[model samples]
Target: MMKKIIFALLVLVATSASAQNGITNDFRFGQGEDSLRCIETITIVNVNLNNKDYATAYTAWKTIFNEFPVARVDTYTNGVKLLNELIKKESDPAKKSEYVKELMNVYDQQIKYLDKLQEITKSKLSAGNILGKKALSYIQYYNNAPVDTIYSMLAKSVEMEKGQSEYAVTERFMKYSALKYKQDKSHGEQIIEDYLNASIYIVEVLDKYHASIERSEKKYQEEGNPRDSLNAIGYGKMIDASRISKSNIDAYFINSGAASCEDLSKIYAPTLEANKDNIEYLNKVLSVMSMLKCTNEDTYLTAAEYALAIEPTAKAAMGCGYRYYKKGEIDRALEFFDQAIELETSITTKAELCYKVGLIHFSLNNYGKARAYANKALGFNNKYGQPHILIAQCYGAANKWSEDDVMNACTYYLCLDRLDRAKAVDPSSKREADKLIAIYSKHTPKVEDLFMRGYEAGRSVKIGGWINETTKIR
Candidate 1:
């Protein structure tokens, strides 16, 4: 036992001397001595950490973290693990919190030292990344911390990192924002701003990942099926993360009830007058209002008009079109819808614009124009079920323009045909298509009417007027 104690003490002295030497040479950047010392200390720290010897690792880790903080990124990462283990073993809550605070300080030191080291080593350790790790630490270990304090850290981290933020940080940031809103109604605008900022950043990240996936897919095809060069797995994880973040954030907003039209009106009305001329602010407000389906509110019109006056993009044009359409002004709505469709370049967006225009024409009782516009939408997106349903409704309403009972009943056949097309092309609309098919089947030309019109059940007949579709008499 005496020999074992002496051996352990000798090992401890050797380790301490080595780490002290590393601390002394930490300031000598680009020197062989400094590099050797850093490597030596790092190896020792990592070995202890890897072996789950947190007590031993913590001593060496602190030396490297404080002395050669920027020498290796692993110092901070490994320090986190070591501190977490120490905190977990502590029975006292206060001591655990102190360890958590030390962990946070380690992250802060990383940001400070990494920035300096980047100038020397050309490393890519960003301040935003360090800040993100700090925020995550607070969330993971300091859950009992003050909400405002945690929220501020998360908000700053998100602002600094933007689209490069960690998925977990974004999620926690929104949760705190919601909590803050519930605790104090006065912070409603801040909550909205936080949500919008997080949403925009999430969308940007998703767009980047989608673009990467596209490039990867193209590379995979060009590589002739070996498939090893494909970054599909990497990009796929990013895509899934973005999607889940979006869905979770959206659900949080909806369940919070803070984004409802009534809430938004109360929140945004005062700010609107002040920011009416602030084009960027107006656009953001209009976007959020539109996303929350508050287009019918007066605030939406105000914001839309402000945004349009500054810049007439597809978004503003669509807002104006929907506003007028809701007011029963079909001509004005059609004009704006056309402008929106012309201004938009995305195929999916164009399809939606065309569908909106078709709906307006249909509402105006212009069956021919509605059918034409609906077909235009299909040309852009062949699988667009809404346009197909709109066209069917137009055909069903065409009976109002028919004079004879036989012709009126025949319009239902045309309507049913379009409904069938909808089901065939878009499986998402299958249930609705089947329900409409059952209802419209009863309206098909009666046997007596068909016979009177000199039409047999299997005989093909030309439907005149606006609808030029041919259908077999049923």
Candidate 2:
């Protein structure tokens, strides 16, 4: 473990000094009591290192100590101390490299720690905050927010903020409060009250930082990059420190985790509504939302409608529409199903649509339309029981009862045998043996003569039915 740590330090130093010699000694930048500025500077330096821009690296390092005296900020003091050590040990190129690595490792650690502290401060002053565990996880991954988790974390923060003002003043709690403020400005004061001083200071810092980020972000926007879509979503309009903090929840969602479609909607909804230009992103999210089934009926309809606008043939949209139809929302259901049928080319899907349309017509008491639809459904899937049933109803409704109807019903019964040949299954069908007997019983003398004739015929043919008919003793 010790060697691994040392090696990591060495790598940073080597990378920092590889392009030029004695660059470490010239490095010095500090923030005098401006922790936010100090962190931002370090982030900029790190960015320079990432791009391998040695000139920027050298300039940024010199600016750190020269720009701000180390006496004012502990973070700057430690940063300077680490950098100075690298300079003094600059005799050995290899050793200097190790020092560079150590410097980078320390810088990264400080940035992460500061970020956490800032978040805590923001949460403490606010109406709510996430758990320390989750915040740590987010910092570790640098990924998007886990949307489902935000709800739990926010609820927990609100509960914590209410219990003790001191607890609320903590950095984590302050971050939570800021987030809540963004979600609903009306509740900002309640949460922001917990850490008044930190809240005030961080607000100013965030303003400077937010502006810098925005300016830099604008360049990316000019290129028509699709990724800028998230930032373009109305995060800019929210300026209150509290709202800014709370809205970071949306940032966390988009940046930190793999979220479902519904999750994306909740996060982007506010921003998308505020900025009409973000409609593209909103539509994208809505597309996914349409595919997702929610327990809430209203949400399903809303998502389905929006999704159909993007993808007319989406199965989820059709399903939602069908549900609406089942629940008596005929117009809405028809709209969805019609789109699905128009867009889908699969025979099975077409059959399903036909069946649904027929059923809908039947429910509306449109017998002629119902018959037409049922016939169309059967034209594609003659063996499907529901369509067969629909056809039967259509005939019965038309008062067109005939022997053919009975035979058709019998064909449906035969279809059941194909479903499971081993187990004889009937969909509430009554035994027809007695009915057959009654029909035969009506033709007494004719039946008797027929029986006698059948016996004569069977005697010559040696058939089973002739013997059965010839048994007149009964």
Candidate 3:
């Protein structure tokens, strides 16, 4: 009977596999062939360890581990690193500790080779296949975390791995097989819907901790400033206040100024511990970024690094970028902005940041760079009035008059009219309004030419004649 049940289970599994071939085969569930082999070896190592085949397991593991000499390169080898860690912590009284020590020595021996490989691949974060940027993030996260936190974080890393792999497969299919998929509207729509759903999930997860604008407002009242850079406890208190103020853990903490990234992380880490789910996605993003810090140039890159360590997201990256920009570190600013824009999906937010970068470039007199940023800002969101005005200014400076400049001029005047109307309706603006009109009237050539120009133009003889005539009329 047991044999019959096992046969039935195998039949069911085969049937399910066959059925999946027809449910729109756009996504690959697990690792590809090459990576699968590595996963299998790691699985064997784990299973052997469980079976008390420690000697045999060590042999399989050593061969497997040696294959990925750069222990930090990808997830599989990183898992081997974790296995090494587990071996070290094994507390069986009868166990030979030297065996674990030997395993670690093997890992150490491979370290220089890994470091050399890291140098070659450091500039390239994402590939089109399985080991993309997000996978790298998982590897880095697992490498850095404490043991307890590492276990807790594994579930997130798994989710990210699935999402990233599925996304890669879907992207490849769309690029390579769009015609085949396009014929089926239902399948196409389902693919789009699923992608959108994943994007929304990630965005909401990031925004969940975006924090309240009101938190700054409250801090300004409580401490008479936005933050205190001097006292570490003050920063920690600010993070606590932000979390406790909201019943749901939706707002993220941001610590700006002289505080290093680690300081910010330490201060807000308590909040992260209190609200784990919202922070999980960010953790993965931050982890991968920390490993790539050798490329960063800003003084606060370490602080930015810390934020990614605490909670990885485009928001934290943007915060770091704005700081770098303020410090006149243009290249570093651009680096963070590039990362932020690629990760961010919000048009409004992206447009706002683009405008800011444009303004920064404009301030630096990098007109060409400024124009590029301004164009990108407009492309992202055309409705923003300030970007239109900025582009108009850019064109005016270049002595190139285009249709966009004229349109922007009209927009500027229309905006001013609306603002003036609003001010006119308010009692407080009445005095200011009169003062503005007095100044506005002087510069308004049309109004001045119509009323004052002709009067001034033909007045001399008439003025003397009017003075004699006025005396007689009175």
- Please give the range of 10 consecutive residues that has the lowest summed lDDT in model 1: 21-30
lDDT (C-alpha) at residue 272 in model 2:
47
lDDT (tens digit, per residue) of candidate 2 on 1-474: 645643443433323322222213321222122333444555556666667564465455555544432212343334445455445646887766555554544444434344333432433223232233334333333235543344345345444544222222234444544555556656533432333333333343334434544654685677766556455333333223333352343343233223444554565455543543443443443333332323234444444455555555445457567678758888887877766667655443466678778887888877667767766865653323456455445433443222333222222222222222211211211233223334433322332544554532223221121111111211
lDDT score, residue 366, model 3? Answer: 70
Specify the highest-TM-score model's number.
Answer: 1
User: Against the hidden reference, what TM-scores do the models get?
Assistant: 0.64, 0.25, 0.27
lDDT of 3 by residue, 1-474 (tens): 645643443333232322221113321111233233444555666777778666566666665555534322442344445445556567773453554445445444434343344444554322222233333333343354343332223323324443333332223222212222343433443333233333333333223222332344456667875353234334334323322322121111111111234543544445544443444534433432232222233323444555555655665676577667667887998788777766766664576678777887777767567767866975764433455445434433442222333222222222234235434322333454445445433332232432442423223211121111111100
**Best-to-worst ranking by TM-score:** 1, 3, 2
Better of 1 and 3 by TM-score: 1
Regions more than 4 Å wrong, model 3: 1-303, 307-313, 392-474
| Model 2 C-alpha lDDT versus the unseen true structure | 0.44
Cα displacement (Å) at residue 285, model 3: 13
TM-score computed on alpha carbons, candidate 3: 0.27
Residue lDDT tens for model 1, 1-474: 644643443443333223333224443212344444555666678778889888888888887776666565677778888998999899998988788889989888777666555654555777876787787778787657788887888888898889788777787788888877877878777888888887767766765665676677688777755463457657766656665677687777767767788878887888998997888888787768766778888888878777788888777887887788778886797788799899876655577678877876777787788888999998876655778888888878766546787777887887888888887666667788888889899888778767876888778877777677788776
